[model samples]
Target chain A: MARYGLRTVALVYLLFLLVLPVGLICWTTFQDGIAPVIESLTTPSALHAFKVTAQVAVLTVIANTVFGVGTAVLLVRHEFRGRRVLNMLVDLPLAVSPVVVGLALVLVYGRFAPFGGWLADLGIDVIFSLPGMVLATIFVCLPLVVRAVTPVLEEIGIEQEQAAWTLGSKPWQTFRRVTLPAIRWALAYGMVLTLARALGEYGAVAVVSGRIKDQTQTLTLFVEERFQNFDQQAAYAAAFAMAVIAVLTLLTITLLRPREDER
Target chain B: MATLYLSLIVLIPLAAVVLRSMEDGLSGFWAQVTTPEASSALKLTVVASLLVALINLVMGTLIAWVLVRDDFPGKRIVEMLIDLPFALPTIVAGLVLLALYGPSSPLGVDLAYARSGVVVALLFVTLPFVVRTVQPVLLELDKEVEEAAASLGAGRATIFRRVILPSLLPAMLSGTALAFARSISEFGSTVLISGNIPFQTQVAAVSIFGQIESDNMTGAAAVSTVLLVVALVMLVALDLLQRWGSRRG
Candidate 1:
């Protein structure tokens, strides 16, 4: 009886909160058949929004992968003063609100600020532009890769690399052969998360992008704009597209995740 | 090199927020944060986040217990579904909630554009945090202890309350803290579902966005400073909790 009660509670909570809502979204997207869904998605501006989202996600993934691996390597392989503080700072983005991140970027890059004023004089628009949007995405997604890979790096330890060094392997060769393969899955998992986050980013991107229609609007901001304009179909279609991407990314993470015993 | 990169990317912008907030000195900062708009938004955010975290604590623990202990069909699928919120965009979550329970929906509960709607969206977004946090702890718990308790004739309730509950408490608290932190900072889903009504449904994150949009940079900075401090405190708390959990383990 107790077992049944526990199972029912779990099933009902998930059904109501997770399954039903996502199911409703998928159903609403196709309720009017495929034509409207395609039409809503194929609009020139919608295409542009998707393009912008892709650019941001790709940029975020590259930047995060490089720095994330670098940071994890530094933290696990070496010790330095204030390493603890540095570790905490890596997680600051996760704890900080996305909107606060956007505001911080604006404070640093908006025209009225000192650095922003200097850049504005050179005709470089950071805020309300692609660079600012990318920066926000980077800030928000920073922790994913580091958090994902750090544990793996710790678990694998430095013995393999040390052995490689003793075998006369150069640092680059040692990293390529010894370190990369071990951390590859974790890194991939991190990048996937970073990609998903960048694609769905709205609050920070919304703040920095200026939502200039085809210029800076991402798929998420596009959904918001369309919904507020009473264009419910277009909004739902765009949202559905994002939802598909999210589901696909989740599937990837699950498949790529190390098995329990493996960990 | 890593430190340099981190300083430029992460530390500088954060410092900029603090420096900007101090541009007007303490008096201005006090005035900005103490305004009715700011105060009400802060209060609402705290209240809603607390409620959401508490609810998730119970529900998430229950889910974690089910996942760890039970062997039902489709268990893997159910487990996968728990992480839907983590991968799904917050704005899409808002739209999902709006579609399912908006004013015109057949469900007949007007959750959209209200405080309750804000809580609902927050509930969805932070759902995975607690479950993910507690699930592992529950999994690692030794069944031998429970079996011993059973052989000694302790009831199921007593064994769980005595043996399992104590071990799970730290994880549950940490997960709740994470949920609260995420809830307080959540803007995307809450922005849409809450209607951004100042002094009513306006959460601090959304209100900060509003302040910035309307060109109140100082006010925005002031409010953000408070949120940043709250986040930092939670971060420290989480770090401590993790250390304690590891020690106990």
Candidate 2:
């Protein structure tokens, strides 16, 4: 009896909170059949939003993947002063509010700020541009790949790499041939998570992107712009598309997560 | 090279926020934080986050317990669904919740633009923290202790309270702290649902966004500093809790 009650409560909470609401959005999007959904997503503005989102997510993922792998290896393989501080700093982005993240970036990189002024003098715009948006996305998604890869790095240890070194493998060769294969699944997992976060980023990008339609507006910003403009169908359709991406990403992560215990 | 990247991306930008907050001195920062709108938003955010944290402490643990201990059909799917909130865009999360609970009549329950709406949005986004944190701990928990306690004639409740609860407490607390920190800083999920009505449904993040929009960088930086401090405190607490859990285990 107790077991049944607990199960029911858990299931009901999730059903109300997670399942029903998501299901309703999909239903709302397609209630008028599929043509409108397609047309809404195919609009020139929507297409532009897609392009910007792709560009930002790709850049963010590439930057973070390189940074994440390097940082994770650094954290696990080496001992240096303030290593703990570095570890904590990696997590600082996770704790920060996205708006705060944008504000922080703007404080240093906005036109009026000292550094930003210098850059602006150089004819380079940071805030309200692609570079600013990418920075914001990278700041927010910084920890995903690192957090995902660190444990696997720790678990694998240095013996394998040392073996390769003794076998006369160069540093880069050992890393490429020996370490890469071992951490590939974890790397893939982290990249997938980073991709998902980059795709869904809203608040920080909103602050930095200036939300210029057909210019800086990503899909998330597009959704908000359309929704507030009372273009509910277009908003819902775009939202539906993002929802699909998120679900697909979740599916990928679910499949990609290495089953260490069974192994 | 990594140090340079870290400084440029994370450290320096955050330092600028703290530095900006104090541009008018400590007194000025304090006054900005204590202003009517700013204070109210902070209060609402803290109070609501506390409530959400407490609720997650219970329901999250319960869900973890059910997932680990109970057998049910569609369990794999439920496991996958636990991550939906994490995966879903916060704006999309708000839209979905608004669809079911907004000014619509599918269920005839509208929470739009209300404080409860804010809590619900927070709950949606923070649902995974406790469950994910506790699930692994619960899986690794030794059933032998529970079985021994039961064999010694202790009731199920007593065994759980004495044996299992002690083990799960550290994880549960850390998860709750994470959820609370997240709730306080959450912006996108609450933006659409809460309607941004000051001293009513507006949260701290939204208030900061408003201040930024009005070019009140000082005020925005002030509130953001407070939130950043809270997040830092939570991270430290989480770090200590992990150490303590490991030690005890």
Top TM-score model: 2
* Model 1: how far residue B93 lies from native, Å: 0.4
Real contacts retained, model 1: 0.85
Task: Assess the local accuracy of residue B245 in candidate 1 as a C-alpha lDDT between 0 and 100.
Answer: 86
List model 1 lDDT by residue over A156-211, tens digit each: 98898999999999999998999999988898889999999999998999888888
Docking class of 2: high
Q: Taking the candidates in order, what DockQ does each have?
A: 0.86, 0.88
Where does candidate 1 clash, by residue pair? none
Error of 2 at B42 (Å): 0.2
Off by over 4 Å in 2: A259-263
Query: What are the TM-scores, per candidate, against the unseen true structure?
Result: 0.98, 0.99
Error of 2 at A259 (Å): 4.8
Worst 10 residues of 1 chain B by lDDT: B100-109
